[model samples]
Target chain A: MAKKETPEVNAGSTADIAFLLLIFFLVSTTMSTDTGLSRMLPPIVPQTDDAPPVKERNVFTVLLNYKNQLLVEGEWCEVSDLREKAKEFIENPLDKPNLPEKSDVEVEFFGTYPVSKGVISLQNDRGSQYQAYLQVQNELQAAYNELRNDLAKRKFNKEFKECSDAEQDAIKKIYPQRISEAEPKNIKK
Target chain B: MAKFRKGNKGGQQKINTSSLPDIVFMLLFFFMVSTSMKEVTLLVKIKSPEATELTKLEKKSLVSYIYIGEPLSSKKYGKEPRIQLNDAFATVDDIESYIMAERESMKEADRPKMTVSIKADADTQMGTITDVKQALRKAQALKISYSARKANK
Candidate 1:
């Protein structure tokens, strides 16, 4: 009768090889942050102790609930309204500019006197969550862009909306400041 | 010739087993050496959905990502999860305001140039994620990406 043959494993050497390989991976691999989106950040506010505080109205607040519903100034509104509201508030002060009598206007923040604060307070119901907040944000940006474009057009021609596209572009390039800092009506409470 | 043939007839070839061990070890070593290290999550087990065609984001700036999870509970629904822009949680609902703030504070060199990345739970509703994306778009945030992991692994 033939003897049965048994397979042998080089246990110690195998263990050593595995250990070395594991160590190599540990040392060589780099961890990465799961990232999303690249945005051109707005310029920083000038850092000066003497600079005045931004008025409450100047800061807009848009709130969202857990259900993904949006609330602007505590009143429920569609996400679309954010842009228009932001544009309006940013473009026109809640008060003034309509008075027939010309009077000395002391600008506390910018434009005519500030009144009735317009703030967007976003209150998320633990349920409505992150994505909902993002939706609200997009609407706001669209509003800003529209307002900016409108302002730029107005600056170059004063009658800009009626001017040729090429002419408007020429004017815009010539007077960048007018287009850049057409400071929207200061948001006032 | 007959004697030589007779002697060879009873002889058997011996197979070498040592090479088998070496090959196994080499393969193990190769995989170990080539395997990459993944992110160390906070010990939270989340089962994300799978996609066949995966695109890796080597650069971080291309996406605006937000993570949605139960703030501190096991309940699947009813509970409101915490919200944050990347890592910073804001108390207000004004997402545009926040983006504007971030944009305004950013340097001229870092002008708003980014893609949005959303890393929400698979179990999370699509509406929430959409809303967040919309917000980014409203801020004129053009590029965006979603964060996903290997479905099988």
Candidate 2:
């Protein structure tokens, strides 16, 4: 009997098909990883005076005016000076009488340590630029980060991020991020 | 020259491109692994501020975005700053409902871990951001991030 044979399908166009799909993904998707400053907003509470007020000395007032200038602790200051001033207030290395007070606290995986009671109270005007606000926030954050890194290196012999979870918790307990962003008041521009 | 020319017998042979499909497939697999599918169509012009201390926003599926800036089409939306949620222009009051919708769409177990990322233009006024913050507080989306680019020192 005579035999009939079927020809193979052409695989030459497979490259074109793959190229089309690759181009589609390249055009539709972005190559950026979302990065940012993460924060937790204070929960809404009913109007009440029950909460205890922070001490006058413990509060580090940061004012961002309409002109996007900074006034730290009732003094005209530049953004460069803010980080050092914040670190000083938070660390109180010299135990300055005017700086924020520190209290002893028992931390996990670490012995008794004095934790600062400083709270950075940030207030911005209605017309202040968001970029300026973020800069100020970044500076303040850098201060805490530097302080944490110093403590980690001195005690744990490692950078802040490289420490173990418990060691990190101990460091965080010693130097917590205490920035408080107050609501903007209506200022006539 | 005559001696070298004698080595060539005829026209040059064609290149074997049987491996072309394999090379293309490699490229296709790379993009598929490295790039994520974009979920939102932004309507506002957002150029996020730059900062040194940055935290990478993980779990793209669990994060919803809020864009605040001047509208892309200023003639229609006016020059005033606007907020965009998903693919539409949204008002400050609409933020609550939008958060609720996003929360409802997610699985029950993953709702608590949801983080709202605010991508705002650097030049925008603080008033617009303050309004958004209040709305977020009311919506109970307490965990939020201000989207920014990594700035080198």
Candidate 3:
């Protein structure tokens, strides 16, 4: 009897097989470059009977109603102007008497309590749109960033990102972000 | 001159494709290494809002996502926006346990670095988001990120 011969397997189609698998993965997978607004939530504190009330003048009230309208200090304000408005409120460039203040700590650039006691009180209605809320928050943050950038440019002759850690910390101390978000209020239809 | 003369052959020469598989395999391996598999199939529709100030989340291992939006199949799961933890639709109450479980699963050293990312639709209301925020604060997950796209210039 003749010895049985094993058939030679064809390997010519290996590349084609790999190409098919590669195409499948390429179509199914998405390369998402995730970007976001980083924020740290205030630690939950137990309600105490003796908590002192924040001064009305120290707080820059920003209210968002159900219709996506903005009310800055009880006056209707446009979203486009929010950044400038917030900057004025925080920096109090003219040393306005009504603006927030802490103990005088003279700094190299801006004077003491530039924004230490200035709190942006943000309150939104339950029916307020998320987009509007986020935009408001963005503008508030932009105000702080712009203030810091300006200070960095003045003191170090460089942009905020180029400043050293200590320099950045100094700038931050002069204009720290003090956004306080209040609980959403119920809106009656 | 010698190198130029070497390419002067008139006869038809078929290009070699024997190494094509090697090049393709290299690309396949590259994609496999760089690409992370989609861990959860999205049931809700999320069109994140656009913003100017955006920061990129650096480490994949240290981040967990919390999705909030209306269900794609609105007929089945009402028109209201809902919170989704992983693949399942969840409520604000589920956040505490979910965060605790996620923290427990991580290495002791990495627990402090964990960040919770909220991917909510632009049209979603503030009420739901506020609830999520409160839950996160209560859970001691202080570091939070609101996922958003970069606005076009």
Q: What are the RMSDs of all candidates, in order?
A: 15.4, 4.3, 4.8
Question: Which of 1 and 3 is ahead in lDDT?
Answer: 3
Return model 2's CA RMSD, one decimal.
4.3
Report fnat for all candidates as fractions from 0 to 1: 0.15, 0.85, 0.75
The deviation in Å at residue A77 for candidate 2 is 0.9
**B19: Cα error in model 3, Å:** 2.9
What's chain A's TM-score in each predicted model? 0.42, 0.94, 0.81
Residue pairs that clash (backbone atoms under 3 angstroms), model 3: none
lDDT of 3 by residue, A9-79 (tens): 87668789789878877877778868988888889898899989888778999999999999999899999
Report the C-alpha lDDT of model 1 over A103-145, residue by residue, as the tens digit. 3344322235323233333344434434444455445545544
**Docking outcome class, model 2:** medium
Please tell me which predicted candidate would have the highest lDDT against the true structure: 2
lDDT tens per residue, model 3, B1-153: 767767648878878787877888888887887888899999899999999988899888889899999999999999999999988999999999999999998999999999999999999999899999999999999899999999998
TM-score of chain B of 3: 0.91
Q: Over 4 Å off in model 2, which ranges?
A: B1-23
Error of 3 at B140 (Å): 1.0
DockQ of each: 0.12, 0.64, 0.67
Runs off by more than 4 Å, candidate 1: A1-54, A93-123, A156-189, B1-118, B121-153
User: Taking the candidates one at a time, how many backbone clashes does each contain?
Assistant: 63, 0, 0
- Candidate 2: tens digits of C-alpha lDDT, residues B30-63: 9999898887777888888999999999988789
Alpha-carbon deviation at B124 in model 3, angstroms: 1.1
**Top-DockQ structure, candidate number:** 3
